[model samples]
Target: MADTHENAYDEFAEAYAAMNETGSWNAHYERPATLALAGEVAGLRVLDAGCGPGILTQELTRRGATVTGVDASEQMLGLARRRLGGSATFARADLGKPLPFADASFDLVTASLVMHYIEDWSVPLGEFRRVLTRDGRLVFSTHHPTMDFHISGADDYFATYQFDDEWFHGDIVMKMRFWHRPLRAMTRALGEAGFGIDVIDEPDPEESVRESEPRAWESLSTKPAFLFFRAFPRYSA
Candidate 1:
């Protein structure tokens, strides 16, 4: 049986990829900020956890990093492999499960806008630390915890729960379920997993969006919906 996250994307691989290419807020906002945070990627061994459709994975390879892209949904991985060709490796692996890589396999790890699909962070964050060299950095973007109310209209700010919402892709609207955890919970998990927080950023939307999609720019600039992080393994990578 497929889990919530797997089912959501597996049924609509091309639709999701199309959104990431053009319509989704991630296309204009989240992805660009993630790449910006990961400056100067030439020759870095990169592990792109939850690398849906390989968009960010492709960019990392373009910047000279050798990358491995992993996703839980085989359908998404299919699209990713087709897009990435041999520029990067593609694998079907769940981020919430034990990663297939050996210890200290990468110089950089990135998970772009994928964590909220997970209900628990401890194991995955631990795996991320284990696969990274001592000097390796982890960069990621996730939905802002503050937007739970907007996305689900939940009254309690501190409660953690699941919510389902309809998102449109061209003429298709799909129902997606994801967990909403408080920021404190995420930070605690990161600390317990042996990562030291290097940066916490509430970044603005990409500058081009301001001119091309003013409504999105204003909405995001006034009340951002994504949070970014840079973390390093503290004890040992």
Candidate 2:
């Protein structure tokens, strides 16, 4: 399949960066949960996969992790590079293919809200497992399958399929495609990719959003939009 999300992110890089800076519930929710699930990142080596404008990458660096950011979009990486300056390294890599890093190169890998764009998880998930040290943790978030299935009005939730959606921020609008897979399918994918799941969380909204973005908080507090998991490599990645 074509990489539509990468193009959308690239075309709307500036707008997406501004939205990420807003600290909205959607923008901020998964990061905090990923960090908490990760325990401590200080002094750890981190790879922020699908880094996108470097939001999570900068945070990992600020929290004292030696960080590297990777994305397919050079426009998005440009924003990340400008925001982080020399503090973090940014690279462009397609997640559908093999990653460039050596095996066990990272102590922790955080992929925030990126996986839904990929239809088949085997290669990308294997790549994540490959770069992680034996005991290193991977924390990632994706569009909740249930929620997407509901919105898609699909007859079979178990069937993996792609759908189109629009993202709006002020005057910037972008169309994107996302793949939806059932939880069991994801569990099977993880198992097949040589990783053991640690935590599966449908966490509450981040507290900061309660006052700053009450509507988003109200919507997200009761209905989780994203699903998160922490896993470690079980066999060879």
Clash number by candidate, in order: 0, 0
Cα lDDT tens digits for candidate 2, 119-157: 889998999998999889889989999889987788999
Candidate 2 structure, TM-score to reference: 0.95
Tens-place lDDT digits, model 1, residues 1-237: 133643888888888898888853877788888998888899999999999899899889999999999998888899988998888999889887899999999999999978888888887899999999999999999889988657888987687888887888778877888778888988898999999998999988778888888888889889969899999889752
Model 2 root mean square deviation, Cα atoms: 1.9
Candidate 1 ranges with C-alpha deviation above 4 Å: 1-6
Estimate the TM-score of every prediction: 0.95, 0.95
Error of 1 at 7 (Å): 0.7
User: Over 4 Å off in model 2, which ranges?
Assistant: none
